[model samples]
Target: MSELTQLSPQPLWQIFAKICSIPHPSYHEEALAAHILHWAQEKGLHAERDAVGNVLLRKPATPGYEKRQPVVLQAHLDMVPQKNSDTIHDFATDPIQPYVDADWVKARGTTLGADNGIGMASALAVLADDSVQHGPLEVLLTMTEETGMAGAFGLQPGWLQAEILINTDSEEEGEIYMGCAGGVDFKTILPLEREAVPAGYQPLKLTIKGLKGGHSGADIHLGLANANKLLARFLSLHGQKLDIRLLDLNGGTLRNAIPREAFATLALPQENAESLHALAQEYLAVIKAELAAVEKKLAIQIEPATSDAQALTKGCGDRFIALLNAMPNGVIRMSDDVKGVVETSLNVGVVSTEADRAHIRCLIRSLIDSGKEDVVGTLSALGRLAGAETIAKGSYPGWKPDANSPVMHIVRETYQKLFNKTPNIQVIHAGLECGLFKKPYPQMDMVSIGPTITGPHSPDEQVHIKSVGQYWILLTALLKAIPEKN
Candidate 1:
């Protein structure tokens, strides 16, 4: 019930409010696309949707600026679906219920979708504002961005005539993203064989939660808590001492988001109960001290599990522990050319245990293809050593930075003039649609920027209330500052 008037004077927030009123989860964005199409038509701008439901709206240059080259404003229309355990909002049909906090705009209990929704809103605001001087503009909004880059990848070549693209998807406001790491997800399977629970063993459930998790790519280098890694560390170090039998294990929800919490159920000999509790406390202190500055609420709790007799073989438990320990979960290398860019990284994102099989999802990212393959090879070898099957899927190539880009000059000058300071130019360890788009336009010039956003893939995702105003001013200035083509 909160009104949009409480936000800043920028009209992008108004468009964002209207976008929140629609239900547009990944792969189900028809209604939102239709709404955008209607808005474009009302403005007398040419608009069209691709076969996969990606929408592109075109606006001609203002009368005197017709000689300038056209620019494409890009953003994804789909959003990652995540909600709190107690929230009852359905991503498929429920509208995002957002409210204004001191300086942030966030939803009640679900993901705010500001990742790219704010991008789409900014593009719309530009398209609707006629008084602003600019050259020809194309607003490209793609679908299914969270699950796969389907809309972006499936976009036909030559669909847009613009050679310069501005992506409004990066999280930081003052930074300009010139390149990004490519990535792929690998699904590893381990055949399961259940065994009868050994006598004198009691089932216990261990839950690791309350970690402040962030984007797997952006925050992976921060040495934050990954629940899967913590849980595996516990089992690896104490499996022999506790005489444990694995029953079920699971952690993480999304491949792109860092695993915040994980849980596992197992049966352990009652004789070692006190020893196991002490070990848990020891590990908790070690991890807490390590992540005290970042994840203040990191927790590890143990309780009796309500399950009948079910367990895994001792050999399997040991092997699982070894595999988890071997898996990589942080920044692998730093860029030599770009000062602070993460060149390579990996995330052991998801793990699930079932009666007949255990599955693990690992996401690997690297600016260099060789580094990416090297990480994959290391993980695959570990899986082989543990006798588990592994297969990689949805591999994407990186968008290497074009240092001699023409747009970079204008972007740098515009940023310096607006902020009174130089913006940091760097490549990110996260996946962006720019890589896929470049496949279609090899010579395309591109740069990414956005208002300040935090907790992008989580329910805590929020956008800064003041940065939107600054972002809009910079974007409009860039469009007008570009020299007109003859």
Candidate 2:
């Protein structure tokens, strides 16, 4: 309903509006891809969809620029589906409702999908606009980017002819990303023995919520509380004093996101319930003061609850607590090469109570392969000690920064020339499709840039209005400046 058509750089804004009108959450992007394929044909450009649903559109070079090397403008097709708890829209069927708020465009109680939608739109606009001089170009719109790098991984090698790739998925307008962290997810299954609730004990629930958990990689160093760790800390510290036994415990939703909420079921003597409450308050006070600046709404709720789930045996509970306390969670090392960048980190993202076993999901990220293995080795050894099974899956490589990259020089010079300000060069701790793309296209020079998007992957996501125009100008200029091939 919002008037995106009237936004500056009307060509780009118009395409963005069409994208926002579709429901294209991760892994459900066929309809949008079909629409784009048809639109590309109507516009008299060569376009086709690959086996994995990635759409590639080709545009010819202008008369004078025929000798320049071709460039691939890459953007993903899917968006992360997240909304406010009270919002009534379904991501699979409902169009995103975005509106201009001050200088930023935001959606109504949901993510704006600006993370890659803006990238896709800018690529589409470049393909459609003929007045801008450029060399031969190809636009690659990938699917299933949010849930994982499935689309990028499925892309076969030797399919693209472009020598350079320009990714429009980076969030900051004034920063160009040259590298990103590689990561792997490991699920540890800890088997704990259960026993009948003791006659003298009663059931109580320890609930923790309102922690501002963020991207496990980017915000790992922020010292945000992992709810699972917090819960385990309390149980481990007070289990003996209060004669505590665990029923089951769960926390977090995604392995790549910091755990925000967690709760544990417990059985303890009724006489110790009041003492338990007092201890919880005391612990809460200490944490509140420690995290006052970041976690303002941090809360821990204590309530009585009845459960048929048997409590973990005292020995099992104690061992479980010890395992949790030993699990690695948070930044492990900072980069020595890239100043202020995190080199290796681990997040205890998820802990779920299953029928027979408790499953813990952790994502480890590092700029170097050995760094990931080091953490994995620690986890494997701990799992062996606890008689747990550790399974690793979906390993992806990092995009190591090339100090001598040719494209990096061109982008930096162009940004300086266009805006009269030097852009920041960064190697992010988060995952990017560029990392995967490099596996097959090793010779392809790649750099990522985009308009400033704040609060990505959440209901508060917004994209700056002014930065969009600036981004477009830089992209247009960069394409023209691409030198002719040798």
Candidate 1: lDDT over CA atoms? 0.86
Model 2 residue runs over 4 Å out of place are 1-3, 84-90, 304-306
lDDT of each: 0.86, 0.88
- Over 395-479, each residue of candidate 1 has an lDDT whose tens digit, in order, gives 8888888877788778889999988999877687888899999888887789998889998877888989788888888899999
**Top lDDT: which candidate number?**
2
Q: What's each prediction's TM-score?
A: 0.95, 0.92
Question: What's the lDDT for residue 200 in model 1?
Answer: 88
Q: Per-residue lDDT of 1-486 in model 2, one digit per residue for the tens?
A: 447889988999999989999999887898899899999999999998788888999999988999999999999999877675458999899999999989999999877899889999999999888987889999999878766678898888888989999999888899999999998888889887988999989899998877777677767877878888988888888889999988989887778777777889899999999999999999999888988987888888999888999888888788888898789889999999899989999989889886578899999999999999999999989899888999888888999888788999999999999889999999998888898998889889999999998767667678999999999999999999999999
